[model samples]
Target: MSSVTIEARHEAWPLREAFVISRGAKTAADVVVVEAIDGAHRGRGEAVPYARYGETVEGVIETIRSAAVHISSHADLTRFLKPGAALNALDCAFWDLESKRTGIAVSARAGLPHPIAKITAFTLSLDTPSVMAEKAARVPHLSLLKLKLGGTGDDLRMQAVRQARPDAHLLVDANEAWTTETIGAFLTAAVECDIELIEQPLPAGHDDILADIPHPVPLCADESVHTADNIETLLGRYDAVNVKLDKAGGLTGAMRLVAEARRHGLKIMIGSMVATSLAAAPAMLLAPYADWIDLDGPLLLARDREHGLHIENGIIQPPDPQLWG
Candidate 1:
């Protein structure tokens, strides 16, 4: 095997303006890009901070730099970084580099026979009821929509959007806003509005309540589950788990999570933190095995790096190598 080295670069995107949520985001998003080089071939990956995980662009860069020595030695990608943004970027870059060296697409290497467009959930950031409703109305043709909720005002926000886009398949991600006492009532309201799934209603440590409460909509674990290590704990509390490349540390852990979640009879949703197309492409390798896909990272960007994944009408096409493997 040829020795490869990984390098990290930091980039930023000034949001067209501040994007608000239960947590706050101001202008300019900080991002880290990892590039792996061996001989003349190169593969790249990008990772973005998840405020939920308390990650920043600088922190992600530091983590990647620490991993660089191991990546140069070509140590096992699967064992290096704990599940988080840094490992996710390196794991993806390694996979990309390997595919390029061998001239094989990730799907083919993973035993998938063909690549096709995947239906994706377009996310609506947390906002006021009327504004969210107006935004939902514009996406009339989307087959799936993921709504962000978690504030004091979410009830009206959800109701308004659901009222406007009644036909769109809807799911809600509270990002750990609702408490145990509120979960049942929230699910009740969600079901009344025909919402299909509710993700991460409670914060990670406080999820025991899920086992006792009856959930009308399928409940999915997001903040609560990372890597395969957390899968056993997540059972019975959640019907599904949202697997993000950043959260699992990369495709390696993601595949492990998929296999184990199937063994435990948990539905899988492949997702991404808002990054760029370079970040989303690696995760696409596992989408064929997931029940729902949320690779809209590029969609959230004011602009994306060139030649990334192409998304149209809320469907994500397979990766084009001009972007990343």
Candidate 2:
């Protein structure tokens, strides 16, 4: 194996507008891009550092830089770094580089079938009920819509969106904002509005509440579940798990998590943080295992990288080779 050279940089992609969720709002997506090169072939990957997990762009970049010196192979990377944004970028880049060097598609390398286009759930950022409804109305062509919900007035927000897009499938993500005391009313409204799924309705530690109550709508775990290690604990509480490449560390860890989640009879929802297509491409490979797909991160940006994933009428086509793997 040839010695690999690594390059890492930070990028701030401007969002078309501020994207708000239960936590807060941001006008730009701060991402770390990593490239691994061996001989002439190059593979690239991107990751968004999440502050909720105590990650900063500077911290993530430094972490990658520190590990890059010893990472001559993809397998070495897995042992060198823990699961997080930093390792996600490096791990994905290694996969991409390997695919390019071997002249093989990532799907084939991962022992998966060729990726087919699928309908992705476009997200409506958290806002007033009227505003969210208006936003949902603007994207009537989309069949599935993911709504970001905060604690208060969640009922009104769901009702408003359902009224606007009566035919659309609905998924709600609370992003660890709700408390045990208030989740009942929220779940009540969610079911009343015919929500397809509710994601992370309450914070991680408080997920025990889910086991106590009858889930009117199937609940999916996002912030509460990261990798396969989290699957066993979430079995009774969550009906599904949202696997994002960033959270699982990369495609390798994500595939493991998906298999583990399935073994426990839990549904899978492949999700993404607010990043570019480079980040979404690897996550897209996991869509076949997911019941709900939310790789609409690039669609939310003001501009995406060249050769980005093509999303027409909410159906995301497979990533072009130039985009990543």
Candidate 3:
């Protein structure tokens, strides 16, 4: 048997601009990365420890370290860790390391098709309606734009963005920021502005109210649906789910989510936190299964690592092996 080593560390990548969402604004994406060495081959994976989920970079790093002794293979991963960013980074690193060691592409090893370049949604950070419109107007080449919402003026915000970029498709993520009183108006605005999808309009536990509301525009479960264990509860309330690798414990749990989402007849949207291309690279492989692709993290960053995934005008090229699997 060859020697193997794995370690985790924290990294912070600056964003081109502050990414303001319903929860808050972040100028830098603080992430935890797991790097594994198998003999002469090396592989890496990244995950952003989101505060909304009560995760911190330090906590995630410790989690990865505690679980390092058990990093034997990818089977029965839940036995070692829970669903969140830490397990995500570890599992992703395992896949990358495996692909490198075995001389096989991750897509092939996973029984998926060859990964390809695909279009992704450019994000418009939450701001005043006019400011958001200005942001939308600036990205005329990106045909799909996902807006950060959940404020009181979402309807106006939607209208302004639409007026500014009528040609672009739109997805709205409220990040569990909306309330029962505000959902009605927001849904109406989404319909009026041709919003393609509305994500987590209400808080996770509070989203049961969604069952009573009419969804002229389809609603997607973000915070409400993490692992497939929560999919049953969201069936009557949600039309789709946004699967982020970090939330689903990397590609392992993420594939399970795709299977469960399909079995439950729910649409899929592959999403990511604002981080470097390393975080988005592995997640991009799921683009084939998603109804929408929102892995725009690299595009939001001020700079990415060498041999990062090439993204031009919101079009994402498959990640090079030098970067990850």
Output the number of the TM-score-best candidate: 2
What is candidate 1's CA lDDT for residue 174?
92
Predicted structure 2: lDDT: 0.92
Q: What local distance difference test score does each model get?
A: 0.81, 0.92, 0.88
For each candidate, how many residue pairs have backbone atoms clashing (under 3 Å)?
A: 1, 0, 0
RMSD of each: 1.7, 0.8, 1.2
Estimate, for each residue in 192-287, the C-alpha lDDT of model 3 and write its tens digit. Answer: 999999988898898888888788999999888888788899988999999988899889889889889999999999888888888898888888
Error of 2 at 168 (Å): 1.0
Backbone clash total, candidate 2: 0
Least accurate 10 contiguous residues by lDDT in model 3 = 68-77
Candidate 2 Cα RMSD (Å):
0.8
Off by over 4 Å in 3: none
Q: Rank by TM-score, descending?
A: 2, 3, 1
TM-score of each: 0.94, 0.99, 0.97
Candidate 1 error regions (>4 Å): none
Ranking by lDDT: 2, 3, 1
Query: Could you give candidate 1's per-residue lDDT for residues 36-119 as a string of tens digits?
Result: 899998988778767677888888888777767765633566456677888878877877887889999877776654776789
TM-score of 1: 0.94
lDDT of 2 at 199: 92
Which candidate do you rate higher for lDDT, 2 or 3?
2
